[model samples]
Target chain A: DVKVTQSSRYLVKRTGEKVFLECVQDMDHENMFWYRQDPGLGLRLIYFSYDVKMKEKGDIPEGYSVSREKKERFSLILESASTNQTSMYLCASSSVKGGYKEQYFGPGTRLTVT
Target chain B: SQQGEEDPQALSIQEGENATMNCSYKTSINNLQWYRQNSGRGLVHLILIRSNEREKHSGRLRVTLDTSKKSSSLLITASRAADTASYFCATFIIQGAQKLVFGQGTRLTINP
Candidate 1:
Protein backbone atom coordinates (compact mmCIF):
# COMPACT_ATOMS: atom_id res chain seq x y z
CA ASP A 1 0.00 0.00 0.00
CA VAL A 2 1.14 3.52 -0.73
CA LYS A 3 1.35 5.97 2.13
CA VAL A 4 1.66 9.72 2.07
CA THR A 5 2.33 11.62 5.25
CA GLN A 6 2.14 15.35 5.96
CA SER A 7 4.23 17.18 8.50
CA SER A 8 1.31 18.56 10.47
CA ARG A 9 -2.41 18.13 10.72
CA TYR A 10 -2.97 21.63 12.07
CA LEU A 11 -0.79 24.73 12.27
CA VAL A 12 -1.14 28.36 13.27
CA LYS A 13 0.95 31.27 12.14
CA ARG A 14 0.86 35.03 12.12
CA THR A 15 0.98 37.27 9.08
CA GLY A 16 4.41 37.82 7.50
CA GLU A 17 5.61 34.55 9.02
CA LYS A 18 7.32 31.96 6.85
CA VAL A 19 5.53 28.65 6.84
CA PHE A 20 6.70 25.28 5.59
CA LEU A 21 4.51 22.27 4.80
CA GLU A 22 6.22 18.95 4.29
CA CYS A 23 5.09 15.77 2.58
CA VAL A 24 6.72 12.39 2.25
CA GLN A 25 5.61 9.41 0.23
CA ASP A 26 6.76 5.86 0.88
CA MET A 27 6.03 4.51 -2.56
CA ASP A 28 8.95 6.26 -4.22
CA HIS A 29 6.62 7.90 -6.70
CA GLU A 30 8.10 10.25 -9.24
CA ASN A 31 5.43 12.90 -9.13
CA MET A 32 4.52 15.05 -6.13
CA PHE A 33 2.08 17.95 -5.87
CA TRP A 34 0.89 20.59 -3.43
CA TYR A 35 -2.61 22.07 -3.34
CA ARG A 36 -4.65 24.38 -1.15
CA GLN A 37 -8.32 23.60 -0.65
CA ASP A 38 -10.74 26.31 0.30
CA PRO A 39 -14.49 26.71 0.64
CA GLY A 40 -16.34 27.00 -2.70
CA LEU A 41 -13.07 27.31 -4.61
CA GLY A 42 -12.24 23.64 -4.08
CA LEU A 43 -8.67 22.39 -4.55
CA ARG A 44 -6.23 24.65 -6.32
CA LEU A 45 -2.83 23.43 -7.41
CA ILE A 46 0.08 25.31 -5.85
CA TYR A 47 3.08 23.44 -7.23
CA PHE A 48 4.33 20.05 -8.41
CA SER A 49 7.65 18.30 -8.67
CA TYR A 50 8.48 15.44 -10.96
CA ASP A 51 12.09 14.76 -10.09
CA VAL A 52 14.63 15.61 -7.47
CA LYS A 53 15.29 19.36 -7.45
CA MET A 54 12.90 19.83 -10.38
CA LYS A 55 9.68 21.73 -9.77
CA GLU A 56 6.94 23.35 -11.80
CA LYS A 57 4.47 26.07 -10.88
CA GLY A 58 0.83 25.21 -10.74
CA ASP A 59 -2.23 27.38 -11.34
CA ILE A 60 -2.03 29.21 -8.00
CA PRO A 61 1.70 29.48 -7.32
CA GLU A 62 1.95 33.18 -6.69
CA GLY A 63 2.71 33.10 -2.95
CA TYR A 64 4.11 29.60 -2.73
CA SER A 65 7.29 27.78 -3.71
CA VAL A 66 8.26 24.12 -3.50
CA SER A 67 11.45 22.12 -2.93
CA ARG A 68 12.12 18.48 -3.76
CA GLU A 69 15.62 17.81 -2.51
CA LYS A 70 14.86 14.12 -2.14
CA LYS A 71 12.78 11.69 -4.14
CA GLU A 72 10.37 10.90 -1.33
CA ARG A 73 10.18 14.35 0.25
CA PHE A 74 8.49 17.46 -1.10
CA SER A 75 8.34 20.74 0.71
CA LEU A 76 5.94 23.66 0.20
CA ILE A 77 7.12 27.04 1.35
CA LEU A 78 5.15 30.23 1.94
CA GLU A 79 7.75 32.97 1.78
CA SER A 80 5.55 35.31 3.80
CA ALA A 81 2.25 33.97 4.99
CA SER A 82 -0.83 36.18 4.90
CA THR A 83 -4.34 36.01 6.28
CA ASN A 84 -5.66 34.94 2.88
CA GLN A 85 -3.27 31.98 2.91
CA THR A 86 -5.05 30.33 5.78
CA SER A 87 -6.49 27.16 4.31
CA MET A 88 -6.17 23.40 4.22
CA TYR A 89 -3.02 22.23 2.44
CA LEU A 90 -2.94 18.83 0.78
CA CYS A 91 -0.03 16.86 -0.59
CA ALA A 92 -0.19 14.12 -3.19
CA SER A 93 2.17 11.85 -5.07
CA SER A 94 1.83 9.46 -7.99
CA SER A 95 3.88 7.36 -10.36
CA VAL A 96 4.16 8.38 -14.01
CA LYS A 97 5.21 5.01 -15.32
CA GLY A 98 1.92 3.79 -16.80
CA GLY A 99 0.45 6.99 -18.12
CA TYR A 100 -1.36 8.90 -15.36
CA LYS A 101 -1.46 6.99 -12.12
CA GLU A 102 -3.90 7.52 -9.29
CA GLN A 103 -2.76 10.17 -6.82
CA TYR A 104 -2.22 9.19 -3.21
CA PHE A 105 -2.86 12.05 -0.79
CA GLY A 106 -1.65 12.82 2.68
CA PRO A 107 -3.95 13.57 5.61
CA GLY A 108 -3.54 17.33 4.91
CA THR A 109 -2.28 20.28 6.92
CA ARG A 110 -4.83 22.87 8.03
CA LEU A 111 -2.93 26.13 8.40
CA THR A 112 -4.45 29.05 10.23
CA VAL A 113 -2.85 32.41 9.45
CA THR A 114 -3.89 35.07 11.92
CA SER B 1 -9.06 28.19 -12.94
CA GLN B 2 -10.83 24.87 -12.36
CA GLN B 3 -11.30 22.71 -15.40
CA GLY B 4 -14.03 20.49 -13.98
CA GLU B 5 -17.22 21.44 -12.15
CA GLU B 6 -19.51 19.12 -10.21
CA ASP B 7 -23.25 19.63 -10.14
CA PRO B 8 -25.54 19.73 -7.11
CA GLN B 9 -22.85 20.75 -4.66
CA ALA B 10 -24.65 18.78 -1.97
CA LEU B 11 -26.72 15.60 -1.99
CA SER B 12 -28.62 13.55 0.56
CA ILE B 13 -30.13 10.12 0.10
CA GLN B 14 -31.21 7.04 1.98
CA GLU B 15 -28.63 4.40 2.82
CA GLY B 16 -30.01 1.79 0.46
CA GLU B 17 -30.56 4.17 -2.41
CA ASN B 18 -28.09 4.82 -5.16
CA ALA B 19 -26.24 8.13 -5.39
CA THR B 20 -25.00 9.71 -8.59
CA MET B 21 -22.74 12.70 -9.11
CA ASN B 22 -21.99 14.41 -12.38
CA CYS B 23 -18.87 16.31 -13.43
CA SER B 24 -18.31 18.45 -16.47
CA TYR B 25 -14.97 19.56 -17.81
CA LYS B 26 -14.17 22.34 -20.26
CA THR B 27 -11.25 20.84 -22.16
CA SER B 28 -10.13 17.58 -23.67
CA ILE B 29 -8.73 15.18 -21.14
CA ASN B 30 -6.50 12.14 -21.22
CA ASN B 31 -8.51 10.58 -18.46
CA LEU B 32 -11.04 11.39 -15.74
CA GLN B 33 -10.80 10.18 -12.17
CA TRP B 34 -13.05 10.28 -9.11
CA TYR B 35 -11.92 10.65 -5.52
CA ARG B 36 -13.60 10.73 -2.12
CA GLN B 37 -12.63 12.77 0.90
CA ASN B 38 -13.98 12.36 4.37
CA SER B 39 -14.50 15.45 6.50
CA GLY B 40 -11.15 17.21 6.91
CA ARG B 41 -9.28 14.19 5.55
CA GLY B 42 -7.26 13.56 2.45
CA LEU B 43 -8.79 12.24 -0.75
CA VAL B 44 -8.98 8.58 -1.74
CA HIS B 45 -9.04 7.58 -5.36
CA LEU B 46 -12.22 5.76 -6.34
CA ILE B 47 -12.00 5.06 -10.03
CA LEU B 48 -10.58 6.27 -13.31
CA ILE B 49 -11.97 6.16 -16.85
CA ARG B 50 -10.04 7.02 -19.94
CA SER B 51 -11.39 9.24 -22.71
CA ASN B 52 -11.78 6.25 -25.02
CA GLU B 53 -13.82 4.27 -22.53
CA ARG B 54 -17.51 4.87 -22.04
CA GLU B 55 -18.18 3.05 -18.76
CA LYS B 56 -16.26 1.33 -16.02
CA HIS B 57 -17.19 -0.42 -12.82
CA SER B 58 -15.42 -1.27 -9.59
CA GLY B 59 -16.95 -2.93 -6.58
CA ARG B 60 -20.24 -1.05 -5.94
CA LEU B 61 -19.15 2.02 -7.88
CA ARG B 62 -19.82 2.71 -11.56
CA VAL B 63 -18.31 5.47 -13.65
CA THR B 64 -19.29 6.69 -17.10
CA LEU B 65 -17.51 9.06 -19.39
CA ASP B 66 -18.80 10.92 -22.46
CA THR B 67 -16.15 12.61 -24.49
CA SER B 68 -18.59 14.38 -26.76
CA LYS B 69 -20.24 16.08 -23.82
CA LYS B 70 -16.99 16.38 -21.91
CA SER B 71 -18.64 15.00 -18.82
CA SER B 72 -18.58 12.06 -16.43
CA SER B 73 -20.85 10.51 -13.81
CA LEU B 74 -20.10 8.43 -10.73
CA LEU B 75 -22.80 6.20 -9.33
CA ILE B 76 -22.53 4.49 -5.99
CA THR B 77 -25.07 1.70 -5.77
CA ALA B 78 -26.72 0.71 -2.52
CA SER B 79 -24.94 3.49 -0.76
CA ARG B 80 -23.86 3.01 2.81
CA ALA B 81 -23.28 5.51 5.56
CA ALA B 82 -19.56 5.00 5.13
CA ASP B 83 -19.95 6.42 1.64
CA THR B 84 -20.81 9.83 2.99
CA ALA B 85 -18.05 12.14 1.87
CA SER B 86 -17.07 14.75 -0.70
CA TYR B 87 -16.74 13.29 -4.18
CA PHE B 88 -14.51 15.14 -6.59
CA CYS B 89 -13.92 14.62 -10.28
CA ALA B 90 -10.42 15.32 -11.49
CA THR B 91 -9.18 15.67 -15.02
CA PHE B 92 -5.74 15.15 -16.52
CA ILE B 93 -5.67 17.32 -19.57
CA ILE B 94 -3.94 15.93 -22.59
CA GLN B 95 -1.53 18.82 -22.66
CA GLY B 96 -1.01 19.05 -18.93
CA ALA B 97 1.98 17.10 -17.65
CA GLN B 98 1.28 15.18 -14.47
CA LYS B 99 -1.00 17.98 -13.33
CA LEU B 100 -4.58 17.25 -12.32
CA VAL B 101 -7.31 19.86 -12.41
CA PHE B 102 -9.93 19.15 -9.79
CA GLY B 103 -13.54 20.24 -9.54
CA GLN B 104 -15.44 21.61 -6.62
CA GLY B 105 -16.52 18.35 -5.01
CA THR B 106 -20.06 17.19 -4.36
CA ARG B 107 -20.77 16.62 -0.71
CA LEU B 108 -22.78 13.43 -0.19
CA THR B 109 -24.72 12.47 2.89
CA ILE B 110 -26.20 9.06 3.49
CA ASN B 111 -29.21 9.05 5.76
CA PRO B 112 -29.16 5.91 7.79
Candidate 2:
Protein backbone atom coordinates (compact mmCIF):
# COMPACT_ATOMS: atom_id res chain seq x y z
CA ASP A 1 0.00 0.00 0.00
CA VAL A 2 1.12 3.53 -0.72
CA LYS A 3 1.27 5.69 2.39
CA VAL A 4 2.03 9.37 2.68
CA THR A 5 2.35 11.14 6.01
CA GLN A 6 2.64 14.79 6.94
CA SER A 7 4.66 16.12 9.82
CA SER A 8 1.74 17.79 11.57
CA ARG A 9 -2.01 17.78 11.33
CA TYR A 10 -2.28 21.29 12.76
CA LEU A 11 0.26 24.06 13.13
CA VAL A 12 0.26 27.64 14.33
CA LYS A 13 2.81 30.34 13.56
CA ARG A 14 3.14 34.04 14.07
CA THR A 15 3.52 36.52 11.27
CA GLY A 16 7.00 36.82 9.80
CA GLU A 17 7.96 33.52 11.35
CA LYS A 18 9.45 30.71 9.35
CA VAL A 19 7.38 27.60 8.86
CA PHE A 20 8.35 24.23 7.56
CA LEU A 21 5.93 21.48 6.51
CA GLU A 22 7.29 18.01 5.95
CA CYS A 23 5.90 15.10 3.96
CA VAL A 24 7.17 11.56 3.66
CA GLN A 25 6.02 8.82 1.33
CA ASP A 26 6.63 5.13 1.86
CA MET A 27 6.60 4.26 -1.82
CA ASP A 28 9.51 5.26 -3.96
CA HIS A 29 7.58 7.67 -6.10
CA GLU A 30 9.56 10.11 -8.21
CA ASN A 31 7.07 12.95 -8.19
CA MET A 32 6.02 14.97 -5.15
CA PHE A 33 3.86 18.06 -4.92
CA TRP A 34 2.73 20.71 -2.42
CA TYR A 35 -0.65 22.33 -2.64
CA ARG A 36 -2.66 24.81 -0.57
CA GLN A 37 -6.45 24.59 -0.36
CA ASP A 38 -8.58 27.64 0.29
CA PRO A 39 -12.27 28.35 0.51
CA GLY A 40 -13.24 29.52 -3.02
CA LEU A 41 -9.84 29.29 -4.70
CA GLY A 42 -9.65 25.50 -4.51
CA LEU A 43 -6.34 23.73 -4.57
CA ARG A 44 -3.40 25.61 -5.99
CA LEU A 45 -0.10 23.96 -6.69
CA ILE A 46 2.72 25.60 -4.76
CA TYR A 47 5.64 23.52 -5.92
CA PHE A 48 6.56 20.14 -7.39
CA SER A 49 9.68 18.03 -7.26
CA TYR A 50 10.26 15.32 -9.81
CA ASP A 51 13.53 14.06 -8.34
CA VAL A 52 15.90 14.65 -5.51
CA LYS A 53 17.32 18.18 -5.52
CA MET A 54 15.09 19.16 -8.44
CA LYS A 55 12.11 21.47 -8.15
CA GLU A 56 9.65 23.41 -10.26
CA LYS A 57 7.53 26.43 -9.40
CA GLY A 58 3.79 26.01 -9.65
CA ASP A 59 0.99 28.53 -10.00
CA ILE A 60 1.24 29.97 -6.47
CA PRO A 61 4.93 29.73 -5.62
CA GLU A 62 5.59 33.31 -4.61
CA GLY A 63 5.87 32.92 -0.82
CA TYR A 64 6.54 29.16 -0.74
CA SER A 65 9.63 27.08 -1.50
CA VAL A 66 10.17 23.34 -1.52
CA SER A 67 13.06 20.96 -0.98
CA ARG A 68 13.44 17.33 -1.96
CA GLU A 69 16.81 16.33 -0.61
CA LYS A 70 15.77 12.69 -0.25
CA LYS A 71 13.68 10.41 -2.40
CA GLU A 72 11.21 9.55 0.34
CA ARG A 73 10.75 12.97 1.92
CA PHE A 74 9.77 16.45 0.76
CA SER A 75 9.65 19.72 2.63
CA LEU A 76 7.79 22.96 2.12
CA ILE A 77 9.25 26.18 3.46
CA LEU A 78 7.67 29.49 4.17
CA GLU A 79 10.36 32.14 4.63
CA SER A 80 8.04 34.68 6.23
CA ALA A 81 4.69 33.28 7.10
CA SER A 82 1.78 35.69 6.79
CA THR A 83 -1.89 35.63 7.62
CA ASN A 84 -2.79 35.08 3.99
CA GLN A 85 -0.61 31.99 3.82
CA THR A 86 -2.74 30.10 6.32
CA SER A 87 -4.51 27.23 4.63
CA MET A 88 -4.73 23.48 4.42
CA TYR A 89 -1.45 22.27 2.98
CA LEU A 90 -1.46 18.94 1.21
CA CYS A 91 1.33 16.72 -0.07
CA ALA A 92 1.08 14.19 -2.86
CA SER A 93 3.28 11.68 -4.65
CA SER A 94 3.04 9.85 -7.96
CA SER A 95 5.05 7.13 -9.63
CA VAL A 96 6.08 7.04 -13.26
CA LYS A 97 7.02 3.36 -13.32
CA GLY A 98 3.77 1.89 -14.60
CA GLY A 99 2.47 4.95 -16.42
CA TYR A 100 0.87 8.26 -15.70
CA LYS A 101 -1.49 7.36 -12.86
CA GLU A 102 -3.35 9.11 -10.10
CA GLN A 103 -1.52 10.80 -7.24
CA TYR A 104 -1.63 9.65 -3.64
CA PHE A 105 -2.10 12.33 -1.01
CA GLY A 106 -1.23 12.71 2.62
CA PRO A 107 -3.62 13.57 5.45
CA GLY A 108 -2.73 17.29 5.08
CA THR A 109 -1.49 19.95 7.49
CA ARG A 110 -3.72 22.80 8.54
CA LEU A 111 -1.47 25.80 9.07
CA THR A 112 -2.66 28.97 10.70
CA VAL A 113 -0.59 32.14 10.60
CA THR A 114 -1.58 34.58 13.30
CA SER B 1 -3.34 27.00 -12.98
CA GLN B 2 -7.00 26.06 -12.70
CA GLN B 3 -8.38 24.47 -15.84
CA GLY B 4 -11.57 22.73 -14.78
CA GLU B 5 -14.74 24.31 -13.40
CA GLU B 6 -17.34 22.21 -11.64
CA ASP B 7 -20.99 23.02 -12.00
CA PRO B 8 -23.43 23.67 -9.14
CA GLN B 9 -20.87 24.55 -6.51
CA ALA B 10 -22.93 22.70 -3.88
CA LEU B 11 -25.41 19.84 -4.01
CA SER B 12 -27.75 18.29 -1.46
CA ILE B 13 -29.48 15.02 -2.04
CA GLN B 14 -31.07 12.16 -0.12
CA GLU B 15 -29.39 8.86 0.40
CA GLY B 16 -30.15 6.11 -2.12
CA GLU B 17 -30.46 8.76 -4.83
CA ASN B 18 -27.97 9.11 -7.63
CA ALA B 19 -25.72 12.19 -7.61
CA THR B 20 -24.23 13.65 -10.72
CA MET B 21 -21.57 16.41 -10.91
CA ASN B 22 -20.25 18.06 -14.04
CA CYS B 23 -16.84 19.54 -14.78
CA SER B 24 -15.76 21.63 -17.73
CA TYR B 25 -12.18 22.43 -18.64
CA LYS B 26 -10.76 25.19 -20.80
CA THR B 27 -7.90 23.49 -22.65
CA SER B 28 -6.75 20.25 -24.19
CA ILE B 29 -6.07 17.45 -21.76
CA ASN B 30 -4.49 14.04 -21.70
CA ASN B 31 -6.91 12.67 -19.14
CA LEU B 32 -9.53 13.70 -16.59
CA GLN B 33 -9.75 12.43 -13.04
CA TRP B 34 -12.19 12.56 -10.15
CA TYR B 35 -11.13 12.89 -6.53
CA ARG B 36 -13.00 13.03 -3.24
CA GLN B 37 -11.85 14.92 -0.15
CA ASN B 38 -13.42 14.60 3.23
CA SER B 39 -13.70 17.57 5.56
CA GLY B 40 -10.29 18.98 6.40
CA ARG B 41 -8.57 15.98 4.83
CA GLY B 42 -6.48 15.22 1.81
CA LEU B 43 -7.97 14.14 -1.47
CA VAL B 44 -8.48 10.54 -2.54
CA HIS B 45 -8.33 9.61 -6.19
CA LEU B 46 -11.59 8.06 -7.30
CA ILE B 47 -11.27 7.41 -11.04
CA LEU B 48 -9.35 8.53 -14.07
CA ILE B 49 -10.61 8.60 -17.66
CA ARG B 50 -8.18 9.05 -20.48
CA SER B 51 -8.89 11.66 -23.10
CA ASN B 52 -9.75 9.02 -25.61
CA GLU B 53 -12.09 7.13 -23.36
CA ARG B 54 -15.63 8.36 -23.07
CA GLU B 55 -16.63 6.52 -19.89
CA LYS B 56 -15.27 4.44 -17.04
CA HIS B 57 -16.60 3.02 -13.82
CA SER B 58 -15.52 1.71 -10.45
CA GLY B 59 -17.87 0.32 -7.86
CA ARG B 60 -20.79 2.76 -7.82
CA LEU B 61 -18.81 5.63 -9.35
CA ARG B 62 -19.04 6.39 -13.07
CA VAL B 63 -16.92 8.97 -14.92
CA THR B 64 -17.28 10.28 -18.44
CA LEU B 65 -14.88 12.48 -20.39
CA ASP B 66 -15.72 14.45 -23.52
CA THR B 67 -12.49 15.62 -25.06
CA SER B 68 -14.20 17.54 -27.83
CA LYS B 69 -16.16 19.67 -25.41
CA LYS B 70 -13.56 19.52 -22.67
CA SER B 71 -16.15 18.36 -20.19
CA SER B 72 -16.60 15.46 -17.79
CA SER B 73 -19.19 14.16 -15.35
CA LEU B 74 -19.07 11.98 -12.26
CA LEU B 75 -22.13 9.96 -11.31
CA ILE B 76 -22.33 8.26 -7.96
CA THR B 77 -25.10 5.68 -7.78
CA ALA B 78 -27.17 5.04 -4.66
CA SER B 79 -25.31 7.59 -2.65
CA ARG B 80 -24.67 6.87 0.99
CA ALA B 81 -24.24 9.20 3.94
CA ALA B 82 -20.58 8.41 3.97
CA ASP B 83 -20.38 9.82 0.48
CA THR B 84 -20.74 13.36 1.80
CA ALA B 85 -17.61 15.20 0.72
CA SER B 86 -16.13 17.55 -1.82
CA TYR B 87 -15.67 16.23 -5.35
CA PHE B 88 -12.96 17.71 -7.50
CA CYS B 89 -12.14 17.23 -11.15
CA ALA B 90 -8.52 17.37 -12.18
CA THR B 91 -7.11 17.46 -15.67
CA PHE B 92 -3.77 16.29 -16.95
CA ILE B 93 -2.92 18.82 -19.58
CA ILE B 94 -1.20 17.57 -22.69
CA GLN B 95 1.73 19.91 -22.07
CA GLY B 96 1.77 19.64 -18.29
CA ALA B 97 4.56 17.60 -16.83
CA GLN B 98 3.19 15.00 -14.46
CA LYS B 99 0.99 17.69 -12.94
CA LEU B 100 -2.76 17.90 -12.86
CA VAL B 101 -4.82 21.09 -12.76
CA PHE B 102 -7.72 20.94 -10.32
CA GLY B 103 -11.10 22.58 -10.17
CA GLN B 104 -12.78 24.43 -7.31
CA GLY B 105 -14.74 21.26 -6.44
CA THR B 106 -18.40 20.58 -5.64
CA ARG B 107 -19.55 20.12 -2.07
CA LEU B 108 -21.95 17.17 -1.83
CA THR B 109 -24.19 16.66 1.16
CA ILE B 110 -26.05 13.38 1.48
CA ASN B 111 -29.10 13.57 3.74
CA PRO B 112 -30.37 10.37 5.27
Best by lDDT: 1
lDDT of 2 at B48: 90
lDDT of 2 by residue, B26-64 (tens): 888888889999999999999999988999999999998
Q: Tell me the tens digit of each residue's lDDT in model 1 across A1-114.
A: 999999999999999999999999999899999999999999999999889999999988999999999999999999999999999999999998988668999999999999
Q: Please give the RMSD to the true structure for each candidate, in Å.
A: 1.1, 1.2
lDDT for each candidate structure: 0.94, 0.94
Give lDDT tens digits, candidate 2, residues A11-109.
999999999999999999999999999999999999998899999999999998888999999999999999999899999999989777689999999
- Evaluate residue A56 in candidate 1 and report its C-alpha lDDT on the 0 to 100 scale: 91
The candidates' DockQ values read 0.91, 0.87
- TM-scores of all models? 0.97, 0.97
Mind sharing the TM-score for model 1? 0.97
Cα lDDT, model 2, residue B13: 100
lDDT of 2 at B74: 98
